[model samples]
Target: MSDTAPKQRPQYRNISVPQILSYRLPLAAKASILHRVSGALLFLCLPLVILPLFALSVSSPESFASLRSYVDNPFCKLIVLALIWGYMHHFCAGIRYLCLDLQMGNDKHSAKKSATAVFAVSLVLTAIFGLKLFGVW
Candidate 1:
């Protein structure tokens, strides 16, 4: 066969379900993308973070007590916990992406490793803070 005789190009248009999921993409890829999204959400959620600090720092003892009481309430506690998860997830994911930027965890296995690291850090942080918030720590 001649080199230029009816050369056929390979087709690259097929996709499979499992072929899509574990195709060996980097762990840091999804983590980094989610990190950016979470960071944006946390930024947009500033009033929620700042208001608590402001309420705690600037108010009188009684006012702070009132704020504390509200925070201690179950509904507020859950909301605060969700915010904590948001912040912790963003922080851990950010660190993972930073590692990726340093050329670490860019492979599929390494990326999964980094993602595991992200979850472990986020979970530990959440548990610590969660217990503290619930006065169990």
Candidate 2:
């Protein structure tokens, strides 16, 4: 037997911390995150924004007229436009998710395409309605 013991093998480990923010996320991941964000925004706005506006608009003829005029403000128009974007994005993304759950477009390339399509459809819809909202048409 040799005086020296057998040499021990060195152990290697993966210790690098990933830079999540700097990393480029896939389109599907980005859309999924935005979907949740838009949903939360709409949910939050429901109690604080839409209900009050609806109540005020239908409370009486005087209130209805005041509410209608209130919406004529540029600030109100912008707020409504934002809400429209939230709604359109949420709806389109929800459909995308439903299809994914059914196992359609579950592949990597298909998922990316679907995500791009979802974003395009949502933005196009928002643009169209936004034009109408701003009285461009």
For 22-83, candidate 2 gives per-residue lDDT tens digits of 56989999999999999999999999999999999889999999998899898999999999
Give candidates' CA RMSD values in order: 5.7, 6.9
lDDT of 2: 0.92
- lDDT string for model 1 (43-126, tens) is 877876756667675778887777787788888888778778889999888777678789976787878887988978898998
Q: In candidate 2, which residue ranges exceed 4 Å CA deviation?
A: 1-18
Positional deviation of residue 118's Cα in model 1 after best superposition, in angstroms: 0.1
Residue 136, model 2: lDDT of: 96
Q: Identify the candidate with maximal lDDT.
A: 2
